[model samples]
Target chain A: MADFFQSLLGNVTNVTWQMAVMWAIGALLIYLAIKKDMEPSLLLPMGFGAILVNLPVGSEALAPIKTLFDAGIENELFPLLLFIGIGAMCDFGPLLNDPKLMLFGAAAQFGIFFTLSMASVFGFSLRDAASIAVIGAADGPTSIVVAQQLRSGYLGAIMVAAYSYMALVPIVQPPVIRLLTTKKERLIRMPYEQKNVSKTTRILFPIIVTMVVGIIAPGAVALIGFLMFGNLLRECGVLDSLSETAQKVLANLITLFLGLTIAWRMQAAAFLSPQTLLILLLGLIAFVFDTAGGVIFAKAINLFAKKKINPMIGACGISAFPMSSRVVHKMGLKEDPQNFLLMHTVGVNVSGQIASVIAGGLILSFFAGLV
Target chain B: MKKKIFAVLAALLILLTPLCALADNPDAVETCPPMVQSQLEAAEGSITENAEIPEAPEAAEPVSEEEGASETSPAKGDQALSFGESLGYMLKGMAGIFLVTAIIILAVVLLEKIGGKKKDGQA
Candidate 1:
């Protein structure tokens, strides 16, 4: 009877305070996911994975999660898979209507590089610095791929930073946007000029972008190619079912796997540290700078343009999808009821998706060349 | 013809000298410098001695490396960059990404122009 009890409670006996603390974190994440509905798809799996790994075991040999991480995250197959879904869901028509919005996408990525240098100042290694900096991309897959590629050893912290910052975009962006721009600047009204994008152009845009970006930044070919392929599936018209499957089934499966596998590195021994705090703090800084970079760049363009551009459109340039764009649109309305910046913000938001993938590839190739 | 014969003879002598030295000194290859020969001999001796040693019972090297990396703290030998150098990298990286973005924007503009022309003609 005693032997049976001992075997049953063996893992319990091995529990440490760190493991207990990690469980509480996992519970908190679960609560947020369920209650706040804050990125439930990602946080739920991540929270569960954290608890699973932190369970006190007689040995450090976590089996399936570790195995999945080695096969998926380490090999970078999951993020690439997720990109297909992201690409399929992306509507580049708005961007096509206003091609200049793509520039804001580029401007927003300034925070990533800026954060890289800042991370190094805080005593992170080159690999860790680069990984932490990618949280500025406001892109989950990009953050995972870069951190994994660099072997940053802080994937758990980095992933949490990227996703949490992404979830908090509605709250985090407004203050930064308001702080940078005046109520007058925020109210600058630009008329919505909708252009009829041709069917052929819609199809060709993905192809041309894939070819051009792939040629210029070969390292990002998988990410760009898969994303473009997904977009192609959507734009082609005949592949509706396949596109839907890619957008829904493929993306969800990979996101679940990506989240859980990420917890392989979240063992309490690795996750409970001061560096994690620094990473979270740095992530917030990067997000602020990203917003500032876009807004400032937009303000700069107003100098050359005959008609002033809405500087809030710049904040939409980060790859938080409809969320960042929606925040900008709401702020525009709050400032002046007549202002309509949804289409404009959406255009810049979609462009940010493309720009971030290109940036990720460039950072990888650049650092690889540097080392 | 005499000049060609003299040139051929000189080439033959240059190539054969090293072969002759090797044949004379069987202990060492003529091409190997003294330092290289000593190092090679030492390596060969060590290899023979190590072949007898049972691989040092698979030391704790891998374990130590894994623990060091997996720990939340800095790895054992990890080094941080100076602020100036980090800033330099950040600027260079920013410049490269922006350049790529510029190229993408240019491509989009050119594509739109051409595609627009085609659509206009079709209309």
Candidate 2:
């Protein structure tokens, strides 16, 4: 059986320690992604990609994988294209109604900078730390944007870490929320009055924001513009079918491709290095700090607010989008069934997504100047 | 209580200046090397500073709000990479995130649409 396997590929007798370890790690990620249903779309593909790289196929025929790596990832194409689908999926209505939630978005990015400094202290170069700090975004687009701009060699590891942490957002955020806010604080229900936003406002919201964020950060134009474009399609009232396509068919198909492509980046030798482990650790730090900065900022706001804002929603300030928002809403419900922080949390959550993207673009622009 | 809520909201909005403050123009792409980046990162902090209170609500005033944000920021390399290559990387990095988010949003929208008690007739 071993001889036959070797004949089909390479010599099983020549299996290196690195390849063996990589195969194990790949298999484990597959188990986690599939069996545990933990980010299966990405992990399954990543696991598959990992397995292929470790298959020991000789000759230049299998060089296509390497080509895929050089062509798409090296140029940062995939991350930007996926933004369109993400924008289509994102509903910024909650945020538009409550524009102040943009503060939470800005605050949530505290972790990225804080972690960048920490990563630097821990021996990573500036660009590498910047890439690693994006894991705090808990939003893959932001991470990809930052990493691609940073030219970090471990884009795959950084991506995997970001997605895994995001899927674990529910688990990660609640503990942090609890640690920061007392039960009374969580129970502090703020009434959400749904504003009857004008159709004009909805239509103009994306355009206006694109103008605003674009002028401030031109690099963010691609991300914020596409995202707002998707939102514009949804609310334009003229392109219902287009909106539906962007949200459903177009979004889903792109997601499938995005998942497979990211998985392709996870070569064992490149991914399983000491740097990969460091990237994972730094990613976690970025998240923790992002949560801290957001919650702390919210608490600071509460000190000055007359209506007693819910600090829990502040934690949702991270760019994990609706997941962070949902976590806050769930926590609110746990504290008081009457409390509906969903809209408010969603407001902050969506804003965080926008803010993170802008933050990402800013980081890219910031780091781009270095070289 | 309602008044307090209003007051709370008003106060919270006041602090929101900082949020708008931190969000300078995002078009800046930081892809410079280590040495040049450290200098650029230092400049990034100032852009946040200059990103102070929104001066003009007019969407037309683009660069005026924060010249420092873009004035000194690094420029993107002029590369004419094909759109296909760009699309693939975006998907690879973001497909999982969008998938999960879409599933959740779909569920929420579905629940709100189909399961909300009878229109204007609920208990």
lDDT of each: 0.79, 0.66
Per-residue C-alpha lDDT of model 1 across residues A1-371, encoded as one tens digit per residue = 99999888866778899999899988888887899988888988899988999987643467877789889988988988999999999999999887778879988988887888789889898788888998999998888888877778899999988988898999999998999898889889999898777777789888888887776667678888998999999999999999999999999889888888888888899999999999999999999999999999999989977789989999998999988999999999999999999999999999888888877876676454323
Among all windows of 10 consecutive residues in model 2 chain A, the one with the lowest summed lDDT is A362-371
The estimated TM-scores of all candidates read 0.82, 0.74
True contacts preserved, each candidate? 0.51, 0.00
Tell me the lDDT of model 1 at A370: 28
Query: In model 2, which runs have C-alpha deviations exceeding 4 angstroms?
Result: A1-10, B1-123
Candidate maximizing DockQ: 1
Clashing pairs counted in every model: 0, 35
Candidate 1: where are CA atoms >4 Å away?
A58-61, A369-371, B1-78
Q: Evaluated against the true chain A, what TM-score does chain A of model 2 have?
A: 0.93
lDDT of 1: 0.79
